[model samples]
Target chain A: MNRYLRQLKEGILDQNPTLVQLLGMCPTLATTTSLENAFGMGMAATAVLICSNVFISLLRKFIPRQVRIAAYIVIVSGFVTAVELLMRAYLYPLYQALGLFIPLIVVNCIILARAEAFASKNKVLPSAMDGLSMGLGFTFALCILGTVRELLGSGSLLGYRVLPESYPDMVVFLLPPGAFLTLGFVIAAVQKLRGMSEERRRRRSAAPADTAAGATAPVAADGAHSAGEADGAGRKED
Target chain B: MNPNQPQPASMPELLTVSPSPHARRGVTTSRLMIDVLIALAPAAVWGVAAFGPRAALVLLLSVASALLAEFLAEKLLRRPVTLRDGSAAVTGLLLGMNLSADVPLYIPVVGAVFAIAVVKQLFGGIGRNVMNPALAARVFLMLAWTGGMTRFSAPFAYLSSGVDAVASATPLASLKGGMLPDASLADLFLGRCAGCIGEVSVLLLLAGGVYLLVRRVISWQIPVSFLGTVALLTFVFPQGGADRLSFMAASLCSGGLVLGAVFMATDYVTSPVTGAGRLIYGCGCGLLVVFIRYFGGYPEGVSFAILIMNALVWYLDMLTRPRVYGKTRGRRGDRKGGGQA
Candidate 1:
């Protein structure tokens, strides 16, 4: 259970394939023009991630090392096709909005990176958990980007006008440059927050060691002083 | 102990040490920035005079947003705040001049912030930015708010309307339909017709450019080559056959050509540093302007032209590299004595 939890944390925060490792950016940049599109894309990619990971893990022992990559792509594509079809039937508008990105998900790097890095080497249960956590992380990042883009680009959230009527929409936010600008700032902000927390942790770990060194210095000084005093006494007796 | 005493001669009060070249000149970044601002002031004044108080408002908002963005970005990025250098002020002023006076208040603010924050500071600030900040912001605004940006008004139309205004086409729009605008050449030259706040007065902008030239604030390469290329192109192919001289004159004065060539294109950070490279960059800008004016969707192509050239500045510099010293003694394959880099 502990190992599973660690793997979950590692996938979501430590090794987030979207934010940290920065894989599968084509959909992350292209499909994140609005929240609905982003949510749909994220969920679809996550589904594929989970299924492919589980399938690859189950077949790891039987799969040959040399031809494993070709086999893994075959499995990943199958899952991607299934997600694409399901969305096409029920969520047609989002599927249309996402357009070429849905079909292109078969080539998304995150699924392949995971299949190679984790599932091929790990057990079925841990591989599935890894897939779940990574999918959640990607969804989280995409949702954030999408929300910002939709809110600023159209001054609405989930097709609802949350901002006042007077708010002027910056159409750039819905465009390609806006994607890069939002992603860059988002990454910079996350790095800054992470840096601050890591600094606090370092200082907390170092504080006691510093005080212990402070306590030892005086004792060492006292021992030197006593040794000098004994030498002085010996000199006086002589 | 020696509170009233000065440092002894053996111990200097200040010590200075740095690498070679040892020559000193009074020219600093701040001084150059101030000079550029001084050169820009006449054009800004003309914009306000022509477009009324609304133009002044846009200019103020642009300058303020730029300064605010610079101060905030510096603080956030934890770099030493160099707002005192007046670079942000220049950028803001340029952006304001490029805008239609009738745009909503938010346009200048957004454009200014985008200019300073994204184009200038985000790309490592100051000399490191790849594109001209003011021009990039203009393009960004143009793309995002095409309707708002292009809703230019007739000259002094705002004097009657107060706030709510109607759309009136300028000379560039008339040229789009392959006809010269109804305004006389003198009106265009004096800038008594409708246009962007800063770009209407070819006379004042040229005067400012001359002042910059006289003060040595910028070199002659970019302005000369850029304007010359544009003039040559339009003269060779007169649009609408409204007499060759008038068409050439109209083409030169109608758009942001003078303002962009003199001010924005000559931005020291984004323009090429080499003498030959500056010429090439300028010519490229001019060609793009003429092409866009002739065939592209928009009437004004100055901002887009300069931006496209700005991207290729590094390659321009590479193509125009000066021969390194002592390289004439060319050695071969480490077989000869002289070291080859």
Candidate 2:
């Protein structure tokens, strides 16, 4: 259970496939024009990622090392075709909206990366968990990007108007350049938050040493050490 | 950074101690900004007078929002406040000039903020921005609000009639359709046409360009090459069987060609550093302007053209790099083999 939770944390926040690892950029940038499309793309990609991961893990021993990549592509495409047909049959609107990107998911880097990196090496259950966690991470990033793009680009979210009628829609947010701009900013903010958390973690770890030194050592020495650490933090940012 | 260094005394004599040959020109970022502002003053005043009080309001809002954005961004980023340098003011004014005067007041404010905070500061502040801020903001605004950006009111329509004067098609729109605009060549040249606030007045813009040229604030290579290429292309292949001279004149005077050539393309931070590179960059801008004007969806291509060229400035500089003092023209490998041979 603890290992599963750690995997969840790593996928969602620490090593987000889209925002952190920067995988599957094509779908992230192209389908994120609206929350509906983004959610659809994310879910579809997630479905493919899980199915491929499990199947690849099952067939890991049979697949030769030289033909592993070719076999992985075949497996990923099978799952992608299944997801595409499923969406087409049930979620026709989303199927039409995502268009070419749904089929392109067969080539999404995250799925292939996980299939080769985790699924081929791990057992079926663990491989499935890895896929679920990574899929959730991709979904999280796409949803955030989609929410921002939709709210600004169309003045709505998930097919509902969120802003006032008079609000001017920034049409650029619906365009390709807007996608790149929003992604760049989202990544920057993620990095900033990660840095802040790391800094806090460092300070927290250093606090016990400071208290311990204060009890026996001189106050000036502790102050100097902290000051030096603060300077180092500032330099790290630069 | 050196916290242990001894603090310097407050005495003026000690502060003045420095390297010899201490004489310095009064030039600074602020000084150059002021020069640009002064050169731009004539066209800005003309725009206001021609477009009326609403034009003044747009310009005022743009300038104010730019300054506010700059101050707020600097404070938020915890950088030293350098508002006194006036670069923000110049960016604001130029952005205002690029906009149609009748746009909703919020348009200029949004443009100014985006110009300063996003395009300029977020990219690492003055002298570090990749593209011209005002132009980028103008493009952003245009893309965001195509209807508002495209709507142009006739010159002095507000002064003679109500503020709700009907919008007119710009000359570039007519030119795009291969028909001469309603305004004559003289009217187009003298700023009597319906267009963006600062771009309509070719005569005044040229005067300002001349002023900058004389002040040595800008070199002539860019504006000359840019305008020259446009004139040559339009003259050689006059659109719609129009007279060569007339078409060339109209192309040179219409839309933002003069304004962008004189000011935006010549932006120091984005343009090439060397003369030859500037010429290539200028020609590239002109060629793109004509290309887009002729073939693109948008009738006016000044903003897009200059921006496309701005991205190529580094390559242009590299391509036109001055030769090393003693090096041969060919590659080092070829040179070594040739010397041995």
TM-score of each: 0.87, 0.91
DockQ agreement of candidate 2 with the native complex: 0.37
Query: B1-341, model 2: which lDDT tens digit per residue?
Result: 33443558765664556787689887899989999999899999999999999899999999999999999988886578889999999999999999998898889999999999888877678887889999999999998888777778889888665557778888999999998888999999999999888988999999999999999999999999999999999999889988889889988999999999999999999999999999999999999999999999999999999999988988998778776556555567447655522
lDDT of all the models against the reference? 0.85, 0.89
Candidate 1 lDDT over residue span B1-341, tens digit each: 22334556687658688898699778888998888888878877888887889899999999999999999988876678989988999899999999999988899999999899888877767887888898899999987888789877777766775655656789888877778888888999888878899999888888889988998889999999999999999888888767778888888888788999999899988899899999999999999999999999888888989989988998998778666654443235323535543
* Model 1 C-alpha lDDT per residue in residues A98-196, reported as the tens digit of each score: 989887888899999999999999999989998998998899899999999999889999999988998878788899988877887777656555555
DockQ of each: 0.18, 0.37
Worst 10 residues of 1 chain B by lDDT: B328-337
- Give the lDDT of residue A168 in candidate 2: 90
Residue B271, candidate 1: C-alpha displacement in angstroms: 0.9
